[model samples]
Target: MRPPSRSSLILFAAVLLAGCASTSSTQTTPGSVPMTQDSTPLVGTDWRLVSAPGTRAGATLSGAGAATLRFEADRFSMRGPCNRHTGAWSRSGDQLRFGGEGGAVAGTKMLCPPEIMARETALLAAMQQPLTMEFEGPFLRLVAGDGSAWRFDSRDLPPAEGRERIVQVAGQRVPCTGAAPMLCLQIRTQPGAAWQAHYGEIEGFDWQVGVEYVIRVREYTVQDPPADGSSLRWVLEEVLERSP
Candidate 1:
């Protein structure tokens, strides 16, 4: 058999080089990690912002009024320092996108204080950017393309089927006018709110006059009651603290 001609050899070499280039293009490059198949760690988790570009380190939604992100299926909802906003969200590999103009966020239109409104604005702006996610144990960090980063801590939600809700409340005792003159706990749900009378009494709690208390109570709805009676019952779970 005769050896291949010089032109034939050149043609074969070109085809071999082209094939190599095509295969290289399809393979993962150096330092590039393939996308993970399991997104279980991210979904169904409640993430509370702990740090952000302009916010203090270890900041919390509850500590700074209220801000939280709950992801479910293809959507997400957040309660900012003042208002609640929700929009669609999608994930591709490590990239996450929050809906923007075409997928505008709809929220409650409650007028809030200037400071709270400002925080909400900043948070909304951050959500509009494209983010890359990283998970570290119970913490999740999102870094935007612009170098803005947000760190969040995981907070597992309680079972939804139960009718009871346990919460911490800060309040004082005040005189209340009822069928019989009585004392009521004047509680404030958030900061900078006027103290309002909580007509319901804390079961198993012995109220001391003129004292303030930060207490945890289990509130449950009454199955049936008198038409003029309160439908919710507050049972003292624990006394967090007491003050004058």
Candidate 2:
């Protein structure tokens, strides 16, 4: 095509830019519309803290403990570095508020290292404050009134997929009374649950008798079948805690 005169080219460029601007204004960008409290994707989703105010860029939960949050059914559960906290949550537009008489932000009594405790305290304090939430794709940003910002990644698992369950067990090895008797890991799924003999080996865990352990295990179904075999399997995901 022939080159346009300087003025003509400038006018054409201005028109093109204006058209582009108009198109952009009309088109809805992903996450451009703010989500309402009741319709927010934050509910029933898990978020792993990626960054926080006063932290270095790209800061994450790389220490001994994880900083995570899960919002479900008007309540929130958070694991801050060391302690686990739970409370009620309410949102109005972009503002999120935490705590009420019975649903105050309460944390576990477990003591952690000074540094971890400090970080946990900071995170808990931020949650207690009212914050504005913004979503960018799978990422979420929360900004507090004090100008502090927190970042989290949307870590929602598939609907069909099962989640890992963490259970504290008073570990012991017992003999499996089967056709071929073998040693098995005796585990308690919960505090009040009876101890059951687990025949399958938990990967990444070196089981020891008489030791207390907090273990994360993923439950899934197996297709193949064996005589007197259970379809459910519990694969170890992590060892959160262990004590003699």
Candidate 3:
């Protein structure tokens, strides 16, 4: 081991660095590296927009009905504060990809209040990128590539049993456009009372156009309704009266 030349010293330093790198790699902690796995059951889960780690603050979360994100089989839908958006979705390990390849999200263009539109714009942008999903109980968090996130809360379980009620249904369908273009049946609690357009559907009930009916029905809030559907469903219990 005579005095080492400059060339030898440089070579020795390089070998030392290479050995240290090998050792460091072998000694790395499992938690220090990201782990990927199949995410929780996202299908049929409807997440209501709420405050999250790095999402917009205050009014955005509190305004309107906020927004909702629901996942399906290879697809996802979002109801923004203003518009309705939908896109193709697929998950790999812990990541969620929106659209298809490089496609953009599609949505309705209905204009809304300025504050609502602002929130909708941000929500739509967030959904168009790569996201890492995490869940904690009833909450879901979607972290974007830039570290920002959108958090949604949910309790999609079905509700308790319903109560039976007696009601009258008109013989004809009236046009109702509350949520979208559709026809609604006129219903009332009393025969002499005013008729209110029933925006929600009545299950298990069939009506002939010229026949009026009085029926006993079971009404309850749906436990796991569709993302854009009404939570209430009325099922016909008994036919008390039917007159043509």
What Cα-based lDDT does every candidate model obtain? 0.55, 0.60, 0.60
TM-score (all chains, Cα) for each model: 0.46, 0.47, 0.44
The pairs that clash in candidate 3 are 158-223
- Clashes (backbone N, CA, C under 3 Å), per candidate, total 0, 0, 1
Task: Name model 2 segments beyond 4 Å from true.
Answer: 1-40, 156-244
Work out candidate 1's RMSD over C-alphas. Answer: 22.3
Task: Please write out the lDDT profile of model 1 over residues 61-123, one tens digit for every residue.
Answer: 343335678776656787665566666666556666676322455676554434445666776
- How many clashes (backbone atoms < 3 Å, residues ≥3 apart in a chain or on different chains) does model 1 have? 0
Q: Rank order by TM-score, top first?
A: 2, 1, 3
Stretches > 4 Å off in candidate 1: 1-40, 57-60, 100-103, 156-244
Output the better candidate (1/3) by lDDT.
Answer: 3
Task: Write candidate 3's Cα lDDT for 1-244 as tens digits.
Answer: 1122210111112111010001122222211222333244577767888764433344234323357788766557877665666656655555666666323456666534333455566656665565787877677788877887777788643443687676778888899886578988988875466778888778778878877766667788788987657678897654545654
